[model samples]
Target: MRKLLICILSAVLLFFQARAQENIQLKSGDLIFQNLDCGPLCDAINAVTQGYQGNKFSHMGMVLLRNDSVLIIEASGKNVHLTPLKTFLSKSAHPHYVGRLKPAYQKLIPTALAFSMAQMGVLYDDQYLYNNGKYYCSELIYDAFKAANKNKPFFKLFPMTYKEPGSGAYFPVWKVYFEHLNMEVPEGKPGCNPGGISLSDKIDILGQYK
Candidate 1:
């Protein structure tokens, strides 16, 4: 009985959310950026990077417009999976931003989404390393577009930094995180983060998704 009530509640919530977002006009393959308020780790992430117009973002996901429902494809939790747009929005407390590809690059959306779909169950890359057979949020988006562009880089990658800006000292959160994993911080490793990708010239920022 409890499970049935939960299902009914979920349906009602989705119905209202759909109506609320009626005018969003989002398209498939839109790059959605979110400011995650997930404590020190997220704080460290924002401290080291800057998003479009200097906004700080800690997470990202891609939009998948399927019929009347809007979903988000992201490498989060234990695997890569699709989440309802409502669910994705609710996960972050800060405003979410959307980026749509310019007309010239719209053709790549299908291939990019197709690549993402094929990676449905890949494990999350908590280590934040490139090509280690796992997918982190931004890395999944990076590789999907790269695959769409025939394995060419559709997005740029840079050496990752885990240090506090201007201090050149490693953030304490990252220090303990890597230490717990028995690995040194992978600084200088090739990586692509949400903040960096938000500044790409290939897409035009459509402002806040809300």
Candidate 2:
């Protein structure tokens, strides 16, 4: 069918794009930002948050250089795990952007990555609550650096808003989302998101994967 052919063509383009990014000299603790295209819920998340340089991001992961291999440590799927860089890029609909810590903060890389590696197999936090013993994408990275900073907060957590910014009402998607989880929305809970971290002054955007 024509639709199937179009899908195949798209896949091919993404594959080559992922391959091209191999030239980028990725280092451990580098952040990889992504727009997951995960539909309405993702759109709602971005609606309340913004990224650096006018970019849009909803998911993020840290680069891990281990044993001469490149991997991305992200809290996705059922738990925290390392995904190959190519696989990570292929999952994104937008060009992958990389972020590196400033010189002073680069020293935290080892300790931060160590903390993250120890969290392998941790549960994914669908509730999006901070310090809930489950790791969400950005929360995992936030806490890793926090631990590296001797329990001091690295990226600041804002009062999470699941509602429309100025209208003072919950996004219908979030209303249904939490209702299905059988819990009230944690509107004012302290939390961090990819978009928020993207705007952090501690790191410098190093350009796109292309």
Candidate 3:
């Protein structure tokens, strides 16, 4: 009886362990969104843009499993690059969430990933302009999927606004940013942002992690 009870307990433990592992396993092409609290710059972005599901995520990346390791393809800082998934999550100020394309769109994953891989080392778009030979985070996703869809974009680009919600004036930080760049703010320019893409109905929320 003692041996039987021990075996039953071990089985229960193994079952729970497997469940935990399944919960965290990420598939290739999953989208990870996070709010990175890098400093005042990130705060400025969160202040201006609204996010979906009550999350004010300021950054995003696409997941890829290469050679048994999970990696994130993101356009950040100076260029588009690959980052380890663990390290990517560590940079988030809020818990990150994973989103996946709906079942009907699953067939596009390989093509999208291939497009993203081809964009490796592309310059990051600090100006956040469309067709500028540089890409911001969400723009990378937009372009990748667009290519996958043979130039028919899966996501739509809306005219960007840098103003605080309900206020007609631009955010003070945006003014500063443009001043630093010695260029006018591209207000009303067609572009994509992480917050907007997070709201897309084509994706299903998979999980959240801190």
How many backbone clashes does every candidate have?
Answer: 0, 0, 0
**Which ranges of candidate 1 are over 4 A from the true structure?**
1-23
| TM-score, every prediction | 0.88, 0.88, 0.86
lDDT of 2 by residue, 1-210 (tens): 999999999999988767756656899999999988899999999898999887789999999988978899999989999998889888976877899999999999999999999999999999999888999999999999999999999999999999998999999999999999999999999999898898999998877784
- Superior by lDDT: candidate 1 or candidate 3: 1
lDDT of 2: 0.92
Residue 117, candidate 3: C-alpha displacement in angstroms? 0.8
Per-residue accuracy of model 1 over 163-183 as CA lDDT, tens digit each: 988998999999999999899
Model 2 Cα shift for residue 90 (angstroms) = 0.8
In model 3, residue pairs whose N, Cα or C atoms come closer than 3 Å (at least 3 residues apart or on different chains), thus clashing, are none
Clashing residue pairs, candidate 2?
A: none
Candidate 2, residue 167: Cα displacement in angstroms equals 1.5
True lDDT of residue 67, candidate 1 = 88
Ordered from best to worst lDDT, the candidate numbers read: 1, 2, 3
